[model samples]
Target: MVAGDGQGKNIHDLPDEIILDVFSFFSFNELIDILQNVCVRWKRLAHDPVLWCDKEYIVRGRAQNGRSCCGVTCSECAHCRCEKTDREVLRTAGMMPQLWTLTMMRGTRARILRKICRNCPNLTTLQLHGCQKMNYSLLKYIFEKCPKIEKLIIANNLLADRQYTELVSCLEHLQSLEVFENRRGAGPVLLRFLADTCSKLREINLSCDYHPLEDVEYFVKAKRDTLTSATVRWTMAGKRCVVPVLKEAASSLKKLQLRLFDVALEEEAATFADLGELHNLRELHCNQLCPHRPRLISLAFQPGCLPLLQKLDLPHATDLPDDAVVTISRGCPSLRHLSLTFATSLTDGALAEIHRLKHLQILDLSGCSGLGGSAVAHVAQLPALRTLLLQYIDDLTDLQPSLRHVLDLKQLRCLDILYSGHIRAVPFEEFSVRLVNFRELHVTYEEEDEVFYKNVLLRCRVKCLGSG
Candidate 1:
């Protein structure tokens, strides 16, 4: 008839953005396969910076439950898995100039990094979780090009002296920075630079434990009452630091944590008064080595202190008395996410008051052994709860008993029952069918019964790990 249009001119006829959008859905290997084809128009379109920048190739493998022989090693990876991804990455970096959002966890050399920054000038949101072979010049090259970066997460400790200094000095415009390594030697220089030049910075996590207040003096000296979020590793489990540093930093801090500071359970009780000044404070995570329940209860009920608090974590807290839970639920009307892990003192009476938190979304009572089905029954009444984690509760033997009542949580998406030694494998088909919308349902079972839940339960993404 009319020459049949000849297969619609292949993919080359489409606009650059449309072609890039279509390429976005394809996996890294598929994209490489498409590139290998000899089509001039397709080749030109494939070189578009948008396609390279918007793409993220995550090489993954099946992870086993228990320790297995094959293991999660790159050696056992499928054919050309690593090479294909690398080729595409190198090609994209060499071809495109506007590529952004690069995340490479495995085997990245400094040469590749330099090539990436040289081509992709607008790169942002870099996350290097466990990247080895990363040196100072690579990091310097990255920061020099992307001065307006918003988020920089360097999870591993693979930085040299020059790289660390270059990162702090050049990337002063960074709004979010997370460093997982213990960089105490470079602390003074980096801290001083951040304090002097990085006023726009908001969230920072330096050490896993809380830092001293004096360490972050730039927060007060530069931004003065404008700082929003901070986490300092004040002490280790065995090692303790003075409270003066933490107290000063807590003055304007909206989000504060004392992750490892365990000794100041009684001494820092008056710092409860300082918390009252943090009117804008929304998240608070406190873990004490020696949990004084009364002090926790007192700090929880501090007048006008936690009015704006939304997320509260007090794990291993044995200090909370019977009435403390009730008092907290009544006080913070906006309190939505709460975690009471390893709290041996909590009982059904404490859970009863939890129903009052109208906006509750997440509830974690991992090690509260005293909690029975009745406590879970009360929490099920919470209308807004989406995730529930109950671990090490020896009292909960039957899932059907509590599941029937908890099914009322229409919004509930995840239920994790990990290491509850008493939990037995039951037929979860009825619950799975009823809760058709549930996304994650993790339950623990004996080694032999693991297969029963793994295959039997329909619409249930089950994870049956070791219990005892």
Candidate 2:
């Protein structure tokens, strides 16, 4: 299948620009670990500096056997973090001038970062994900070296209490800072400095217990329109207190995650605002928030409210009714990904309304006990759906009809029904030959079907999970 013109027949002869764009999507590890070994042209494309800069390019530091490479350009060559190879990788990365966003994987040596930080003159974004045993000195070194760094994401690492002047000094240019504390990294010192300076800050995600209620309010008020994304841990009382200030920049805020304190939230259900003012919000997530049942009906999502909203995840809304979901469908019509994982009160009527989300691609109704097999038929009509999770719903008893209904979803790649007790092995014997474009199927299976599935499911061209 080639173009009508014979001159452009080969798909392999794609333009260098198009190829570079594709290569840019590869993670840093994939670029070195996979693309560099594909072929000569691909290897060259993988090295393009333009593809590496100004993006969230992840630089993974893999474990080496504590020995330097023998200068052989083979596997474990410079990709692993040995003393000599670390320098080699850094030197190679130095060619990518004006590199902005970078993520260093955990276990990556801090010494390697120190070697390269001075070279990142234009670096604006840096994230360190679980580089073991991190301390104040190493962080200060990065802050002092990369003066233009505006965004810093530190997660899953041990950052103990220590004072550093570089953090205080360089935070003046800071725009976005996120620190998922492990030991004591995001303590009073960083919070105090952030409240004092960083006037240009647009996003702050310090999802740590150390985050005080006052700091959250201060950041929202000070940044106002400039603050676009906020992820913080708040108690039920703190959440109520911030709702008023949240309206100050409701139009500007795009993404918000309110992870409640691990306590019984029933105490605050009498006085909680149902965020209807965030009209321009693109994403909203509420973690472990199970409000009173009566309050779920009064969820203030009016029709066509969040027109620009694309994602809504309310995982612990225990008894969310059909009308509330219908309201979400009408209000968040533009939603592409929706999750009401434990909304047990929703019925088939809500799925009917959810079909209105024409652009919806991912839907997760994992523990909604009110749904049945007919619900599958309703969602099957969704043209753009790719992933559907309907786990732990024992009410989905009509397995045969559900399987047939899902065939209509041409784009469905992953279908999860992990704990659907009604599923039997007999119905799935023919499933291997019938399914189309099914990449993954999660179903609880018996011991007898294990060997049959181990061989036959591969022919179905899908990854079969839970077939122990």
Candidate 3:
């Protein structure tokens, strides 16, 4: 009987596992729009719980009233039809049993959020951006349902005191929390609550006030052995509130970033000295948030301070003199990345000292007007130097000699000379031929230099920036 009517092969004839494997390559949107409608077997595969795990849905566009998700009118606007559509979408997608992350944008409805928490029990990370409707009840519902959540990010959302308190109480297992643009000062209470409840908490980024600074000090003291990274953005008046925290966490803290709105005076030199105690610190960023305030130049580090430090960023510190640069070069031998942007006092002599950091890969001397082509010769000496930024170094008129010197370093990759006014011309073809390993080259933008820059771009990646 000829083996009873043999038929041609079809995609459905493949094993279920193979079909699922193929489905894995398609994104959630693609699966919904194309693959699901292909056939019954594909539809069934699309609905499989494994495909939804780690899926991310990003909804863009502002609310109908032209106000963002965190706007005051958000809760009162019943006419926001877009909210309903978003809620419907969330309700449909929230049914994924294995979904682990949820990012809610500005106009997301409260009921929709409740549906998500109720549906997606496996959610471990929740990011709320401009989510105005995030009240105490909604937050409590999420915490009660999604008990495994470990990371929560709230940006540009002004939740009430009660809401913040409830939110903290619920995040008992949260390992990381970031609250940005929080004007209401929920930081102190939140830090205290996290310190008390979330013993596993290792990372925190909070807006700093005097009260919050006290809370942070206490938190660091209490959890000195656990907390590893902390980033504080100062908003209120404070002098030495941060120093005590650093002192307490000196042995354990690995990364620290402080954005100070106020100037650090000579009197606070002792406070700055406290950083020397952080021997385990690998990354340290000290930024002066208030431009009107003179940069904290009085702050100096002794030799062997932060010996293990790999990354140091102190941009726009106008008073970073040669002595400070020398101290940094002496102290941080293991440093790989260093940024001293806008350091007006940093001269060629400082670069000579910095060249001693053999492990240094990235260096930014942007806006250091005192530096000339002589500084590049010193930079060329660094064995591991890969990326060099010399933007706004106005005195650097002749770069060809320095560029020629750097060409010897086989590992050199990125070179930036943007806004260097005095460099009248560049040997683009010569640079392209010599610097075989170059990945990016940045030059100052000029109408006349278009052809020169275009030629470089054709040979290698090039970016042009306007002279400041």
Candidate 4:
């Protein structure tokens, strides 16, 4: 019995499947650390295909570690360890044959990538960010190897017009794609390919260098069946060209995003003129475009469309006339969350309408310089408001520090009043002592001045008045 137990100890103590399960809990770095210390049997077990089933590549080092770290330049820095750490790391990782996902920075060595692809035949999800060194050959190799890829993020400046078309033509099964500006491909060509091939595509983040609006239109028309979300951030040159395309394609889209440089509100608003036609649209975001305030009046008050609306984010919608707010509140009673950043046009009257929004959980009014103490006071009264951002508002008048009373929001989770100007001082001791139920709080006031904020909340919590 003793001899048999010794022989069993000499062999692997656990089953192969159990060993793989144990290794899955450790990260690649942790596995590498284990490999450096463990014996041959453990190292081989660590390199099992089950352990490398989901390869997650992390891209670090930008400013400090460059040529190969951030941009296209590839200069070796011994101190800077990007993706190209050492040959042994690559050799050991190159064993898995059934790779499901490959997420690596473009800065990684092509040799390493070749090994990875050769080993992993069933790769499904591929994400390469800031991979400027990758050439057409690597992309072609990836397409050939991973035909079943469902999600792809290639932010490498490698694919030209021809290579871009060829590579995209191969990824017919992709459901989601995110291509950053690092790639050197014609946006229109990629869009055209997506329209032609990717029928199951649902979400796309085409943040690459701008493409002509005509291409945008074609792609939108192609994915009209399943395309719901698109995030398009064009370069300065691309913005002007894509607006016309958006105007034509806006009718069918449910979720759309644009990053503008010096574009006008009128032109941006025109893109959404056909937005009302997107009857199935539930979410809409405009990063920097002038908010379609006038259209808000029509869309909000009148029974046009967007009955299934839930979330609306209009960051640059600066001039939301009071009537428009009323229209929206009266019209879309089903809205759950609303984000109105830099909305300079919203007045105290808008707050009255906001109260009617019983379902609103998150309200972001960041950069709205027009909102003053009165508007803020009204906001505090919102019963359903959970998260509120009031950054960059200048004018704030004297409201007693114990504002926890007038604004009876026990459900509040987060409050941001940074840079909202001087909050009038009230006695730290007499401040409305409520049960401090908040989880997160951000105040732009100084430590010395924060007596009205921190101390009051802390002291009130002791009394347990506002305890939820």
Candidate 5:
């Protein structure tokens, strides 16, 4: 039999790119924790550098979510009952001394985490969320052993009263720091200390009510030379504090997210105008959730911030008009990924402007109630689109038939229609192997809808990546 004839060859014969494309759906955490243990072939493929470069060499330990775990073949995660994930991660970390990325969720025991940190001394990127499950000594151990770590993320966790100052100070080479909570030890003290001691820090994301913007300003003033990305959340009443901070880091700032607690301040002094000064700014997200509604107010399309952006998200921008889309098209020529979720005022004119962006690859028009089915045609003509999201377009009844436009997108890989009101499951029946790049479909979660997609995707060899 020939190599192609199933008689002699097996999955090992398939090209690596095909396998990596399927593996891309699973996070790095899942890849090492479960899939690598399935068999020797997969274990070897699991450590492929292509996958590692895309998501880093992450070792994960997460709690059972009741859904299937491991990969597509497994129906359920029976091993989770005994917490096999943690043990497997501990073993893998020790085995793979080259691992540089690690994420430990709530399930991983503190001792196991400490062990992994002790083993992976070459780590450069580390993320630990749900830190309530562990203690401070584990972090101390990680810093002591993994001193070369440059990017660090700690979320949904707390810290000791003034211990953050001591802990973070240890990573003299730290470049990126993201801490989502600061009810206790995380605040100006940590940032201030890093500013004084560490000059390589490039990114900072802190979400807290503890001395919010005032201290961030101080850190930016001190370390503006290297700061490139900044994301901060606070309970304050105004967004004016961020103006000067952005100005200070304008020369180096490339990515920024600021929480505008009070929507009124967004329009008062045109504070967002200051962003126009940041000629180097690339990505801006001002659509922070507010007490009344979640709208990204007019952070105008400053000519300076637009041209260089590769990704832009303006979700729930109720006030965004069609003209703003015009500015986006003319200003952001290199824009690749754009999200206008719930921008209810836009019509087909916005998509027309977007169609002008020849390099656009990902488009999210979810909840754009004003858009007509013509959007389907406009986006289908785009040359490089790989992912398209149209989640809440319930009123656009015409979308059901116009979806045939998707067949034209040869590079399209993922199309999401979660909670898409009028579109039924029947249209997806036509999708098949002819659309080779199409691998993932996101559908609504009703029993009939899920069953229909499962049957169709099974025949098409596509993955149904959960429901909205």
Candidate 6:
């Protein structure tokens, strides 16, 4: 191969394996738009089955001008191209033999969905988003044809009573199911069906508004041993609905996320106590929609709860105080990722405790108004920290002390300090010189400081984004 003449050594003359490897990096749409029309060799490489193995075909109904067909101006716009329908897009995408994921966005028709279910036998993940026309027949067709399907995500769809029952009856083979923002509730019948038939289910996510507490209790009691991950959001029901579900799945559950709409301080405290029983839990996300409630510091600060927990996300936890941070640092030493966004009660004291999390990697302290430069100094102690988001921490004034410490962490990759107005005056040239391994640096500065930082970052050869 090395002996070939210079004329025969062009890119197109490369081996088929090399060409296919290059094609693997491009999205399906990009491949179809650019490489497919280049030449016969490129077209053949683009059509290789390996390129489509885990590809996701996004079928959305929108005019060429990027506006909905139903919009008032779509009919008169020069680039509307309303004639191209969802069926046409699906038909073209269904020609691929190895596609494993199909995401049907708004305006997908029932007949087109049925055709996809019939044609794409290898499809393993189907996500339907805002597909108002999705009905019982289309879902049943999917279950009948794609027997090996493993995950189903249904969001913002409307299902009638009969259609809902048909959908539940077809979930016997699925391993994961996620339902969110449905216009009509699936009701108790759907839960009963899942409990009785979907015994192999390992993950379930329900964020709908119409869930009944009784139905959830029944499902938890029936599927306790088999369920491994569960996420329930926006449920109006109180502790009665949440406690039973947690208690039943305590032994087998690994990941749990709860976002309750109506909850009292005492009720939430009680719920946190139940979580202590889930010793095997690895991820815990608790969000309260209600504001101005008492802090959950005391309940979550227990010493022996969730020994294996690795990720703790409590965004919008307005009541989280510094004591809670100390508790987490002492108890959840295994945590690798932590988020305390909008936790206004946290101060430099919390950051001192958080520095003890030796394995911590990704930390998001955005909107924590109480945090200052001292907190940033504490963050530099973590050896494993990679991505740090300090957006909206307006009190962060000086970056000199923090930058000195951060330069020592060789693993740091991304640093975002957007909207920290007081720190804009620091010489970012120092940062550009010290953070040799940074992949991305996001900052916001006044117009006067932009040119200085841009020139300094250019010299350091790093990607910089935002107002600067």
Best by TM-score: 6
User: What is the clash count for each candidate, in the order shown?
Assistant: 12, 1, 1, 3, 0, 0
Q: Which sections of candidate 5 miss by over 4 Å? A: 1-93, 107-110, 130-138, 155-163, 182-189, 234-240, 260-263, 266-269, 288-299, 302-305, 400-413, 422-461, 465-468
Better candidate by TM-score, 1 or 4: 1
* Tens-place lDDT digits, model 6, residues 1-468: 254567766675679998788788776556666777788888777778788765566555564343322343333432122224765665465455566777665655667767777777777787776645655566677777777678887653432254655565465668888877756544423666676777687788877646567777778778788788888863434434465456787788899887764555446666556666777789988784333344554455467886688998988877687777788888888899998888877778887777778899999988888765577678878889988887876555544456456666667788777776665544455665676667677777766866776677653433444554
Residue 357 lDDT in model 3? 94
List model 5 lDDT by residue over 251-354, tens digit each. Answer: 78899776644535444335545555666767877573332322222344645455688778877776677777767776777788889889888877776766
Best by lDDT: 6
Distance from true position, residue 11, model 1, in Å? 6.3
CA error at residue 227 for candidate 1, angstroms: 2.4
TM-score of each: 0.72, 0.70, 0.75, 0.68, 0.73, 0.82
On TM-score, the stronger of 3 and 4 is: 3
TM-score: model 6 vs. ground truth: 0.82
Candidate 3, pairs of clashing residues: 69-106
lDDT of each: 0.61, 0.65, 0.68, 0.59, 0.65, 0.68
Candidate 3 lDDT by residue in tens digits, 309-333: 9999988777766777888888889
Q: After superposition on all CA atoms, how large is the RMSD of candidate 5?
A: 6.5
Off by over 4 Å in 2: 1-46, 53-112, 116-125, 129-137, 147-150, 155-173, 183-196, 209-212, 236-240, 261-274, 381-383, 392-403, 410-414, 418-461
Q: Kindly report which residue pairs in candidate 2 clash with one another.
A: 106-130
Error of 3 at 67 (Å): 19
- lDDT, candidate 1, 327-378, per-residue tens: 7787776778999888777777887777778899999988876665567678
Query: What clash pairs does model 5 have?
Result: none
Residue pairs of candidate 6 with colliding backbone atoms = none
Sorted on TM-score, best first, the list reads 6, 3, 5, 1, 2, 4
Model 4 C-alpha lDDT per residue in residues 1-468, reported as the tens digit of each score:
122464557335667786677667775555656553677777777667676554443333344443432333333221122344536437655544545656564356777666767766677777675744666787788778778888887653433365665676677788877767763553343567667776777787876544666666777767666677777763333445354444444455667666653444555444444445555566766565444344433443344556666788777766666666666666666677788788787766776666766777778877766554456556665677777776666644433333333346657666666666654431234334432455555556655554456556653332111111
